[model samples]
Target: MKSILFRFLLLYFALQVIPLDIHYYADVFSLPGSHLGYRGLFVLAHYTPRFFGSTPSFADWLVVAALALIGSFVWQRRQPQPDWDRWRYWVTAIVRYRLAIGLLAYGFIKLYPLQAPFPSLSNLNTPYGDFTRWKLFGMSLGIVPSYESFLGGVEIVAALLLLYRKTASIGALVIVFFTGNVFMSNLAYEGGEYVYSAYLVSLALFVLSYDAYRLFSLLVLRQPTAPNTWRLALSRPYLRWGAKAAVILVFVILYGVSAQRGYRHDPYQVPGGKGIVTGFYNVSLFRIGRDTLPYSAMDSIRWTNVVFERWPTISIAANRAAHIDASNTEAITAVSNLDKTYESQGTNGRSYYDYSFDTASHVLRLTNKDPRLGYDTLTLRYDRPDSTRIVLSGLSPSHDSLYVVLDRVDKKYLLEEAAHSGRNNHQLKL
Candidate 1:
């Protein structure tokens, strides 16, 4: 009876992991854009558009549950349930590899700080109230790359331990506790990985059940417990050790190295500065159609303040009423940074633009970044008087000849200051 039930549970988890996790197979190879690994991720991104609000939405879960039931019903129950010990070794091997693969994929991403990158220059400039709860949580982790690395290290430790017979239970237990928190965090932060995280948690629990009764008696009820998890002899030692060696080589060393390369060159998160300077500037002077305009709160035709991101984005604050996007789901795969839409927070109240600078021509060709609205293109010639001042002259989005002077504000962020300070008897100054 126990064996039959366990078999059904195993099948259920297999379905869950096989369909949802692209990383199961993608992390095994190195990448450029055309590489097999990148292709796999690309395919999954398009095919598996995460459910509107939740991954594996209620309808998805219902489909998988129904399949598990039908599979269980057709398993020939009248033939009598087999002894659990006879197949426990095979069951454990399946769980070990599955957990190892999943954990290693997540571990390497975090290990390199690509999963939650350091907050970009734009994020720093944005108002705190404008950020979504999920963005806030993610940016909080992004600040301390070291902490993210530690989290990755923990997952990798579990993956390594799960590869062995004696330590598999311990690894499963770690996943249960660690991923349980991850699932809960996703819930609290309005994150999108809740279903996948919960699936891992469930798989870990199933694996732990092998030793659950023994652990309960040993620790909880304080009774003697026997270790009866039977195993096959090491007769095919070459085949067994060879397989283990290959897994370590490919998943641990090769995959780790490849992931690090991706992190260095094309990290999967919102970029920090896109090689541009970031700052808040005062629009000290504004002219429309060759006529100088006084700075007024109600003047939409004149710029007042602007924030330049380290990324490819900038925002101009004026008397404009902008539309803000309120969605919180994070996209893991992207064709462009704009697709992820992380920089859109607090943008609705301002005119947000993404720009490409031509250093040779001193030109700024700006395009409206907001999807809800469009504006005429703005083309301007720019000159830096010094590191602290910029001058622009060109055509406005309204097709008027324009001139502006921007003075960089001397600014300091509390978060950056906190990160730089030591946690001793030192006082924190804002």
Candidate 2:
């Protein structure tokens, strides 16, 4: 019985260790342009579009399905020759210790001092920005006031609870809920399909399952009250110490292996930063900037910046704007309104802008409603007419709109007017 249980555990760990390409399968199977519904598992199983030849890769699907089946088998019915006494005790002890370690690690990660400044949402235009953006249901929930500190506090408390056995269960419960929320949100926002919410959800579920199983065995099954030889050994000081040490060593090795694989598998570390600009999107206050442009850049960008920021106030506006050409109509109209409003309120000087790539022209366009430019298009054509600078161009009826062509390659900004010629238009050459 001990050998069989050990083998089962080995098999389970091996399955986890295997680098199954679930994300690849998800991409291949996903319905193009559709949000993979609310449930993560459901999306994995059924959301693939058949028409586009999108279907789950056989190997990945098989692996996940098989593991789930095996887990169900283990959980559903008791073994005929159930040695609950020995197996239950060992499993419970191992799980408790692992939970402790996991909690401590999580706490440290969250509580670590901010060596780097918090990423500005203006700079970080991605789905992750949605996390910074507060929302309840579909409506805007206001700018997330002090989210980092609040979440950090919760993580600290949860970690503390998990470290002590007396409070560990409660801590696990809290972590389960909190991480679960993050996981769901990640899925909802279509964060990274590979390493985002799904990974956290899996870890949370594992902890929840192990803790719940032990709790059931201890309280309902009343396994602790039952007598056995292993229990007698466990009661001894030397054996107890040995068991704890063994558990710690095993977990340390497992964690090391997992960490190595995680580092190798993850291509993007942290997910937000300015670099070779490819894509940008914003939600609420959070923004996502990706290095790869998606086919739906226009809709995605508009939804992230304008729709999510203003929400219901612009909900009807967004609906009407969706069918229109984003660059020409929707974008122009929205920026015009924003410029008028801001100028009227005497807040014209300072502006917040979200820029994203234009897939058609391969140009980066600024989406700001500044009064100075009258909400005109600001096109950043990289390597245009020169390799050292990005040429900024704009179309306006009056005064030819100001352009600050920043030469990122040379670390200089050449300020000029769009349509004007000669050195006079270079107002503040720097």
Counting clashing residue pairs in each candidate, in order, gives: 3, 11
Instruction: Give a tens-digit lDDT track for model 1, residues 1-430.
Output: 5655666675565565454544433432333455534223323322221323334554666666667667766764644565556455665676677777778878887888877777755567666776778778888888888899999999999989888878878899999999999999989987777776776777688778878888899999999898855777776879878888988887788778867877776565553337256788989999889699998978877887888876777778777766666555444455455554555652344666777788999999877767666534678899998999999998876688889999999888877777777443245432
lDDT of 2: 0.37
In candidate 1, the residue pairs with backbone N, CA or C atoms under 3 Å apart (3 or more residues apart, or in different chains) clash, namely: 273-310, 322-348, 323-348
Candidate 2 lDDT, 11-110, residue by residue in tens = 4433443434455365435544432111121133222112222232234434555675576457535554555456545554444444444443333222
Instruction: Please identify model 1 stretches exceeding 4 Å from their true place.
Output: 1-7, 20-54, 77-88, 233-239, 272-276, 290-304, 318-332, 335-341, 345-353, 368-377, 421-430
For candidate 1, the per-residue lDDT at 344 reads: 62
Mark the regions of model 2 whose C-alpha exceeds 4 Å error after superposition: 1-80, 96-106, 113-117, 121-146, 193-232, 235-430
Clashes of 2: 11
Prediction RMSDs, each to the true structure: 4.9, 16.9
lDDT (CA) for every model shown? 0.71, 0.37
